[model samples]
Target: MENKELLKRIYLLVKPHRRRLVIAVVGMVMVAGLTAGQAYMVKPLMDRIFFDQEQALLNILPWAIVLIFLVKGLFYYLYRYMLESAGQRVIRELRKSIFQHIHTQPTSFFHKTTTGELISRIISDVTLIHVAISRALIGLLKDLVQIIALLGVVFYLDWQMALIVFILLPVAFTPIVNFAKKFRKYSVSNQQTVALISNNVHETIAGQRVVKAFGMERYEAKRFSDLSDRLYHIIARDIRLNSLQHPLMEFLGGLAIAAIIWYGGHQVLSGQSTPGTFFAFLAALMMVYEPVKNIGGMNITIQQGLAAAIRVFNLLDTKPEIKDQPGAIILPPFRKAIKFRDVSFSYNQANPTLRNINLTVVAGEVLAIVGPSGGGKTTLVNLIPRFFEVSAGKILLDDHDISEVTQTSLRDQIAIVEQQTILFNDTVKNNIAYGDLDRSEDEIVTVAKAAHAYDFIQELPEGFDTEIGEGGARLSGGQRQRISIARALLKNAPILILDEATSSLDTESEQEVQKALANLMKNRTTLVIAHRLSTIQNADRILVIQEGRIVEEGTHANLLADGNVYRELYNMQFKNSNSEPSNLTP
Candidate 1:
């Protein structure tokens, strides 16, 4: 994005709080005026009170100086408060907008990005922009106004001295601008390293069980240490560049002060200028450098903020690959069947995962899909919910192309229960009600009872209100799967997809969850991906897929009679189960 365009976008974020910004700017103006007034008072104090022995002016002048500072302090606090308040509001809105945009992105986008990286951008990068708005931009404007006001005082006292100071001022900006560029380059590097460290920490903590089991603690520690060390070096370089600005500004400021003291003092002693006038000029000149130095520092901050903004805007600019077409109609509830007409899909164009597939699933029929790992079973089902777009061909629901309907309406008619149960760190009630948030307490209990989850749930101390730990770590695998079933059961959609829902459980748990799955799948058009062939023996039909192609399709008895791939799979599973001692009833 262009600089102007970036600035305009930032301005829009602040535009909502423009009234508060205006009030803050008014306070800044008052502060600048008071700062100039303090310098202006120096002349009367020196010449009238000290030199001329004006005793009456003495009592009033001291009080006036105190009063001026008291008012300036008040306005200073007000403006800082106002700007910071506005800055916080802007940060809140920006973070929300970025988060909402992230949700709009396709699943493919997440495959290419890490959760840690996105979290870092939302937290760290947005903070940089916050500082830029609340500190850098406000400081730049306030300092500029103060410098201008102080310069007026200097020129009024003596234009010749003011002209000399102005001439050398532009030279000081050269090093400041160059240093700012270097600071920004280092800042970007620092943020990237921080993001890597975040990713490492997130992965380490999330997979800590694996780390402990594999005894890779030392290796993970060393990896994190290396990333932390890299970050330290980048930050040190940024600090070196940042520290250089202050002393460099002081050197240039010292030179300007030295010139003013020499030439202005000479004029005073030679009777060409009054002592009071020369002192006032010196005071104003000294005050002017403070704001100038601040402005120089703000330039570096602005650069850092701009770099961060570029990253944030780049993410926001990404258009989601899957969105409803313009004028798309809302799909009504499923009635007849789902048809995939010559469907093909590929994550990358070089390789296809599903190829020229034509399949129809009639309403209320349980269609079992049996396949080897990586045979596109999951990919085929995911396309129904528009999790990914098909590379070629189209899917239709009762003759209406699914792409011609709103995704929300299409997904509303379907519910999914996957192998890995996903439950948030919330109450059991909330997790179950997620399927249909409008469900009442009684309705939630009904579904829980239907999924066989109510027995253990009531055994908990808090019953429905118990807080489940992250991903339901507090619950056993069987309990979690039952809760997942309860969630799906509550949706009561016309279509259901069960992807190896009982694969990870033991015999006892599988038997328990299989009952819950039966309750959830009742009267729904169900698609089952069976990990164990025994679970789907009663399915209306079973399709065997291998290497992205349907190799066989028939009833379990028919497939067994044919002695094809399905029969071989059935025999292998049957032999394996028979060889092992089993507690589960046949």
Candidate 2:
């Protein structure tokens, strides 16, 4: 990310909260003015009471001192609160925008990214930006004010002394800048390692069950330790570099101060300068060095923040590959057919997954697709829902090109039950109702019955109210698949897809579920991607796909009579079914 573009983005986030930001800036200015006023008051008090020995001024000095402190303290508290509150509000909005963007990103986007990295960016990088704005900016402005105010006082008291002080400024500042530059490099390194450590911890915790099951707890721990050690060493190096700042500044400032005091004392004795003027100049010189040191430290923090900002901007700048086209329209209801014409697709263009596939499924027809594992059956079905775009050719619904319709409209008419059940870690009723979240309980029960899920659900301790474990691990594979079918049934879409939906079930469960499926498939354009040929032999048409093209298409009876690929698949399954007598786990 270019620095100019990055700053522009960051500035936009602040724009919504501009009123608060302006108030914060006003508060900072007020605080700096009060602090500088208090510093300026010191010299006046010393000159009147000690050097001049003015009796009346001496009598008023104590009260004046107390009043200055009182005013400074009040402004300090008020402005600090205002700046902090404004900064926090900006941070809140920034985090919300980032999270909302991530939520809307498509499934394919997540397939190529890691959850660990995304989470770290939202949690850690945004926080660094927040601190930079809230604390560092305020500190930087105050330091600038302090330097300007103190320099003005010193120059007013004695121009020659001020000039001398200015000449030494570069000498005192050079090493501090050089040292901070090194620490800035180390700071960026440390931050990256810390992010790496966070990613590792998130990954390990998410997969802890697998680690424990394989008895690899020690191995996981050692991996974490190794990553953490790198973070620790990087942090140690950064700290060492930061440590050089304080003493180096102090040494240089000290030598300059010692020289100033010696020269001033000689001038006072020789009658070239008065004790009052010399004392005031000396006091102002003492106050100048602190602000200079703070400014140096603030620069280091800003550099670290810039590094974090680059990562954040990179994420924000990324364009999602799949987005709605201009003037996209909602897909009308499916009254005729879903057609794929000369369709070919690949996640990467170099290696095609689906090639020149031409097919159509008319309204209320069952189309079963059978193929070897890598022959693109699943990929072809995925294109119907626009889970991915066809790299070449087009898919049409009712002869309307799907790409012309909005993604949500295209998906609203279709439903899918995959090989694995995808139930949320929620109550059984909610999982089924998730298909149409606004559906009434009565409606939920109707669909569950239609999927043969009501019987097993009622047998559970809490019936529909029972909390199913993550991925529905609390239930058997057959039961989970039934719940998934219940979800699809509840969707009541015009098109239904079953991708090996019954492959994991027992013979008895399959028989019961098949009855429910028969009912669900009635009057809908249905597609089944099946591994078991027996389940699909009854389909209205079986499409035997091989190497991304349909090699055979016919009814079960005709395909069997033809003695082709479908017949061979049917015979193999028939022989196995007759030979293997089943008395297995239910």
Candidate 3:
């Protein structure tokens, strides 16, 4: 996007606080006027007091100087405070908007993006924007005001010399523009590099056990150091570029001062101007130098801010790929079955994950889906929730099409217990009662008992209120699984999807969680993606999906007797144990 357009968007954000901004601008004008008035005082101070030997002027001069500076300082504080408060509020609102927008994205967006990158954009990039809005933009306005007010003073004192100083102002703009371009390019790279570092840190921390098991601490550290090293070089270039601007500006300011002194001295010596007039013009001209230098510094910040703004707005502009269709009605409860008619799905345009799938899961029947890896078992079930819209065809709940109904109403009737148990860094009770926040404490305990999680809950330090560490790190795999099952139980959803819930458990834990799973699946229409042939032998029917197509469907005994793909898979798990284990990878 063009910087001009980006700036307009920022204006819209600031528009809400225009009243405060106006007050700040008024404060800035006061400071600018006071600065000009201070320079103007040099005339009378020089002429009436010293040159004309007016000793009586001393009585009023000290008080006048103090009052001018006192008011200038007060206005400075007021404007800075107002601008900073406004800037912080902007940052707060932007962060909230970005956070809310991110959650609105489809699940597929998260699959392609890293968690750390999102965090970096939220924290680091927005902070750069804060710097630009509060410091740089505010400084630019104040400096511009100072320049204009000081120019007016110099012109009133002597127009010919005022014109001379004004002519050199544009000379600094070329380098400032060049530096701004370079700063923007580097700033974008800088934000990306910070995201990389954030991603690396997140991965290492989340997978610390894997790193330790592989003895990869030094390797991970080396990787982090490499990213930091890259950031170092980028920032060094930034510092080098930033450092060059002030010196170039200072040199230009020196040239302006030299011209002013030589020209104003000639005027005074030729009696075309008084010492008072020449000195007052020189003072105003000198004051212009500081604002010019400040403008140079503000350029770098605005550029960096612009770069951050690009990433932030880009995220905000992304629309969720999956959202309720206009005029879609709330889905009624699942009754007869979930029907997939000519359903197909592809993660990308080049490859189909599930092809021409036709299946019906009855409202109260347990359907077991078994297949070799990459056979689309989980993907098929996920389609029911509209996590990813089907590439072609439709899914229906009884007579109602799932696509035509609102997702909230559709998902309200379903519960899932995935292979990897997901828990939060919160109390055990809160985790169980997550979806249904209105559940009474007694109800949470009842579900806990039903999922066979009560025993462990009672044993925790704080009983039901015990804090489970990040992702339930403090709990055993079986304990976490049971807690997850308890959560599903509390939801009391009528449709259940179990994606190999016991896949990672040991024999004892598996036995415990299977009891919990049995309690969770009671009377609900269940779809089970199996990793073990033993677990789903009692399913109403077994489906063998291979290479995105259902190759076989029958009772366990019938499929085993037929000695086809289902039999082969059964033998692989029970008889031909040397074959690779079953899992849902697609």
Candidate number with the higher TM-score (1 or 3):
1
Give the lDDT of residue 288 in candidate 3.
Answer: 85
Q: What C-alpha lDDT, on a 0 to 100 scale, does residue 343 get in candidate 3?
A: 92
Residue clash pairs of candidate 1: none
Off by over 4 Å in 1: 579-586
Q: lDDT (0-100) at residue 252 of candidate 3?
A: 88
**lDDT score, candidate 3, position 148:** 92
Q: Rank the candidates by lDDT, best first.
A: 1, 3, 2
Q: Pick the candidate with the highest lDDT.
A: 1
Q: Every model's Cα RMSD, please?
A: 2.1, 3.5, 3.4
lDDT of 2 by residue, 1-586 (tens): 6769877877887777777667666766666665566556666676667777789987787787788778767766766777677778877887787787776677678886677678777888787777777677667887787778778888887788888899888987787677656765776776677767777887777567799999999998898899888888887776776787778788888887888888888888998977767877776777778888887777777767767777777777677666678999989998999899999998876888888988989999989898777888888898998888899999999988988989889889998998667889899999998856789989899988877889889999999999998778789888898889888888989999998888888777776677778777888999988877767767889898878888888876787788387777767767756554221111
Task: Give Cα distance to truth, residue 414, candidate 2, Å.
Answer: 1.7
Clashing pairs in 3: none
Greater-TM-score candidate between 2 and 3: 3
- Candidate 3 lDDT, 220-244, residue by residue in tens: 9999999999999999998998888
Candidate 3 ranges with C-alpha deviation above 4 Å: 269-271, 576-586
